[model samples]
Every structure is written in structure tokens, then in C-alpha cells.
Target: MWIRALQAVLDRGIRQGRLHVRFPDGRMGSYGPGAGTGPEAQLMITDPALPRRILLNPQMALGEGYMDGGLSFPSDDDLRGFLQIAARSAQSGRLPLPMRLAHGLRVRTKGLMQWNTLHLARRRVQHHYDIPDAFYALFMEEDLQYTCAYFRDDAMTLEAAQAAKMAHIAAKLCLRPGLRVLDIGCGWGGLALYLARAHGVHVTGITLSQVQLEAARSRAAAMGLSDRVAFRLQDYRHVPDRFDRVVSVGMMEHVGVPQYQAYFDKIHGVLAEDGVGLIHFIGRHTPPRVLSPWFQKYIFPGGYAPAFSEVIPRVERAGLVVADLEVWRGHYERTLRHWQQRFRANEPRVRDMFDDRFVRMWWYYLIAAEVSFTDMGMVLFQMQIARRSDAVPRVREYLYPAPGDDQRPSDTA
Candidate 1:
């Protein structure tokens, strides 16, 4: 009975591509058009009860089943191909009745689910970022920039692109010597150290994760910038100093919907009257919606990538002006693609670190995130904000000078 139910769900969810399924009882079934049509994928079910679980909660069940060795593809390459087809189908398909109801419930109750109180926020940060730092070093670039890289040129390597990302944000901040800067959600002190070394600024970076705090401080000391840069294991809300510049990269998603006002207020409070800041985050072009059940449960608990509409109002209410907003389409997709390749290349190392289950989970996470940026409405938003309109340059040209224009915007203008 459960097998029949799952087949019906798949028939509706995958009309554009073929999903060939081999059930636990050796019964074969296929959904969508014949093999000659669009993209095709095949999977085998190893557990008899998996069908009922998937029927109840397709997203969560599928991730868990894959991790637990209950669901698998014919080959490693087939896994990515299957995910692509599934993502495309989900973009244009409807969930089953039970799943739809559950999705709606999550959307309606998202505020409660993502409250993210101070203590709760710390716990959630440790849940993901506290994973052994060595494990992350295997896949990430030398700088350990876990956020999206700026691909200025299509041919740039991951390391070059990450450097470009820092330079891009630094340009927006309009740095000068002896300026005081604050780095919120500073990951590994990369950006803070960059600001100090490149711009000759004094930087204070804050994070909730102890591992990140230690790694960031050690990097600062090694770079001989400890005097110019500082790392703290503190929340943004508790900050009490003013800064000439502020920047947060890939950090706002964890600031829950309920805390949006307070988050902005904290930024507003700490920013000088003439301060300029930039926030880089993953945001959706679509209307605000609940986070994916699988992602929230297994990856980023209490996290939500918000819509621009959900953020702009809070910025306005905080008395902050949006100096500029840039949408980066296809950049994160490429970044995730690189990370996925690196992860696959180091699959043996990862498996040795944990087990086969951890390998499957990470693989699913990387592929799912890549597909989200590709097929879904996900994109990166680089918002330049200020306490006053005159804090930044009146023209956007300052952000993008000619190739050989090496001087600062103020110096050139």
C-alpha cells in the first residue's frame, strides 16, 4: 500500500523527467515520460519502510534515507544527475497533500521556530560551525572562506575568487588609514585581517562560535596584525562600541525573523553617525518562505535566507539608508560547484574522518545547495548601507573604476 502511495506522489512530482525506482520487494516502477525524453535518473530502495516515511515527509525522509544507506543511485555521478532532475521537477511540481499541509504549517509557524534567542543562537552556531576545523580545511580554500566567493572573471580559481570577494566588499566600505571597523559574524578573521592589512584599519570581529574565535585570533597573530585586529566570542547584540565602518559576510541568515529589528538596531547603534557598512548574505528573489525542512533539521538549525522585502523594511525602520543593493546571480552556484568538486575529490578523507553516513550527508548537502542556487530563486545580495545618505559616494561609479585605476575613489575623484 505504501509503495502504491509513493508511486502516485512521484507521478505528480516528476512529470518532466524520468525517475526509475526499484522497490524493496524487487518490483520495478518508473515515473514521467519514457527514457528518451528529458533528464533521467534511477534509484533503489533498500528499506521496506522507506516508502511510508517518504510519503509522510518527502524532503526530510529522502535526506535521512540517503544518509542511512536506504536510498542510493547506480553511481556517484548518477547522484548529481538525479538531484538535478529532482530539483527541476520540484520547481514546477506540487507536493503531495500531506507534505503540502506540513509545508504550510511550517511557513505559518516559522517565527516561533526561528526565534534564535542568545543562548539558543550559540547552541545552533556550535551545531554546524563547531564541526572539526580540519574537516572544513579539506574542501575550503586556504583562507577558509565558507561564504560565497565573488567570481569577477569566469576563469578565476576558488582562491582568486575569494580574494576578489574581499576586495569587492572592501571597495564598498571606502576604507582609509586609521579607521575603526567592526566585522560582525567574522568567520576565521579573514575579512578583519584583510581590512587591517590592506586598508590600515583597526578591526574588531565578533562571532558566537569558539572554534571560529580561536582560529581567527591565531591567524591574526600569525599575520602580525594582532595589534590592529581583535577577535571576540560575542554576539552582535552585546557590542557596545562605535565604528566608522561595519561589514557582515554570510551571517545574517542565522539572525531569525523575530530578531530582524534588534539585529538592525544593533547595527544602527554601533555604527557611527557617518558610518558606511555592507552586508553580504544569501537571499531569495521570491517572497518570504520557510526554510527547507532537511536543511533546517540537519544543517543550519534556526536559519532562514530571507527575501529582500523582508529585510528592506527593517533597514528603513532602523533609520538606515540602503546606499546600494547588488544581486549576484549564478555566483553562488559556481562557488558551490567548486566546493562539491573539492569535497568529492577528498571523499576518502571525509569518510575516514566520520563514516559513510557522514559522506552521504555532506554530499547531499553540497548538491542540494548547488541546485538551490541554480534552479531555485536563491541569490546573493550585497547591500551597502549607511546611517546617513551622505556617508557614501553619491555615484556608484566609485565601486567599479577602470582596470588600471589603482588609486582609492577619494584620491582619484
Candidate 2:
């Protein structure tokens, strides 16, 4: 029955023009069973070895299979998208049994997983952020903002969404002229330069990657905002001065479970009296017993998304009041899709630096991420936090159009 169901879906995908199997000679055909019989299909079809290769060495095999002229796709992105959908559905009920057992054992001996150690954390940070600046620049916008973007409307381009994100974050922080703003894990200094150049705020950005720090500094100098915005190659724990506002975007995932409290404490310690801190993060609906093995091994090694229950307690413990919480779930799906599109458009430039496997791996990661957001209804949260004694303000509110708004489209300039 399950096999029949799978075949039916595959047929539907091909019929709908969503999946097209490609032959070695570069001719595309429908993905039906008999479509593999033609002479053109000799490269990829009728060989048990092909499927075995793909399944056993998932990342490397798939990459080599595509590159060695053994397999092809009408659109690599769409092929992976459909494959992810099918895999997730097939594994929905049955695969979680072993996952549950593994999670239970990990939870039983929590400390046995050395993910929280400083060495491991540093290694994880380096593994993801240490990718060449030029490689990231291939797809990321000129500003090089690496987090989820806030779109004022669906018609808004990625550039506009990124600008909106910076403006929104700055407004939330209420940056005034000459006030010091601290950006934790600042990527490429987009927000820092935005705050300094647009809002006349003095910004200090910290990052673990030397590549990011140098790129940010050069960008700041080019923009003539070097004096107002500074990028430091340092960790958040070692930041020396207090600031009027603190903003950490997409950095919380790296803060392991055991270090959550300490992370918050350090942020709280550096924030001035009545200061505001805006934390933007991708959150999970429920706490996972363990990080996904694939993500831990391939993508972000020490990263874990936190549930609201886990986050709120830490904020309260750090003596901060959450004055406002805004959830932007669908916006992230659009943001990631935009990124995937940009990456695809620049594939030639990217392939020059990285191999086919790395490219496929990243594409799979992004598409799978998009599917996860759609399936689980996960959220992106931007919380306005302040010292406990600071009174919450009822400022005049401004609401933007929702995800489907037609006014904004295309993230390009």
C-alpha cells in the first residue's frame, strides 16, 4: 500500500510538471517507470547501483551522480524539493521510532553529548561562518545580512525586505543620535552600517569570523561610516562595554542548552539601565531531545532551535521584561526561497569555489528548511526586551501588509 501511494505521488508530480527526470544527453522526460527504457536513459536507469549509491552515501553519491553525467535534472532545486516532500512524508510515522530511542538515550545521559564545551562551540561557529566571504557574497545581497528578512509586502524585493529588517530592528531598539548600539554575531555589518548611516547611531558589531569582521570593516570604510560603525572579531561573552541597545540576530541557535542562562546573563550584564534588546531568532514549536544528526554533521554542528517555553524562562531569569513579541512565520519561508533563488541564479560563480556536493548539500538544506517551515508552521520571533523596571510603552503602532501582499515582489534591487 505504501509503495503504491509513493508511486501515485511520483506520477502526480511528473504529470504536474513539477518533476522532470533528465537523461545523460540532456533530454528531459517524465518520471514514470517506463520512461527509463529509452537509449537516452542509459546513464542513470536500469542500474541497481545508481539507487544504492544515492541511498548509501547520500551527500557524496548524489553529488557525484549528478556531476559524472550519470544523472540529471530539469531543475536541481525542484528535484530536491519533491524528494524532500516525499522523504518527510514516508518517514513521518515509521522513522521516528529509532529517533525517539536515540533521543531518549541522549536525554538520559545529557552531559554525555559534549556539544556545550567551548572548543565544540568554537568549532561549530567556525565551520559555518568561516566559509569564504567571497563565496557568501555570491548570493547574499550587498549588505550581506544573513538572517530572515522582514518583508513589508509580498511585492517587496529582497533588498527592500532586508532594508525593512534593518529599519524595523533599529526602530525597535529606538536608537537615537550618538547612542551606542551593540550587534551580537553581526554578519557582514549590514545592520551596524544601517544604524550608523541611516539613524546616526554609533554601532559596535561583534563576530567570531575574521572573514566577516574584515569584510564588515572594509564595507564600513567604503560607505564612509567607519568611525561610527566598528566590527570586532570577538565573542559576545567578552564584550566590554554597556550599550543603550543590544540586538542579536540569528545567533541564539548556537547558544547550547546548558549555556542559555549564561548567554542571557552576559547580554544582560552589558546592557545599560532601561536598555532595550531585540532578539531575532528562528524558533521551534517544541524542544527537541536532540539536534538532527544530519544538521549536526553537515550544516550547523552545535546549533539547536529553542522553543518559547525554554526561551521565556531564561529571559525572565535574567531580569528582563519582554515588552513586545512579534511572530513572522511565513515571511521566513519567502526569505529562504529568495535566497535559494539567488543561489541558483549564481550557481556558476558558486561552483567555481565549491564542489557539486557542497552545492547540492546547501540546496537540499535550504529547500528542506523551507519545507520544515511550511509543514510545522514554525515561527520567526522578534522580541522587544528591556530591564524589568523600565515601563513598557504603548507607542503609536504601525502594521505592515502580510505575506501575500502584492505590493512587494522580487528581492533584487
lDDT per model vs. reference: 0.89, 0.69
Model 2 Cα lDDT, one tens digit per residue, 320-349: 888889888788889888988899898877
User: What is the lDDT, from 0 to 100, of the residue 102 in candidate 1?
Assistant: 83
The residue pairs that clash in candidate 1, if any, are none
lDDT of 2: 0.69
Summarize candidate 1's per-residue lDDT along 1-413 as a digit string, tens digits. Answer: 99988888888888666778999999998888756656677899989999999888878888999999999999765676677777767666476667768878999999998998899999999999988888999899988999999999999999999999998899899888888999999988899998899888999999999999999999999999999999999999999999999999999999998999999999999999999999999999988877778899899999999999999999999999999999999899899989988998999999999999989999999988887787668999999999999988888777788778765542321
Deviation from native of the Cα of residue 145 in model 2, angstroms: 1.0
lDDT at 28, model 1: 93
Every model's TM-score: 0.96, 0.78
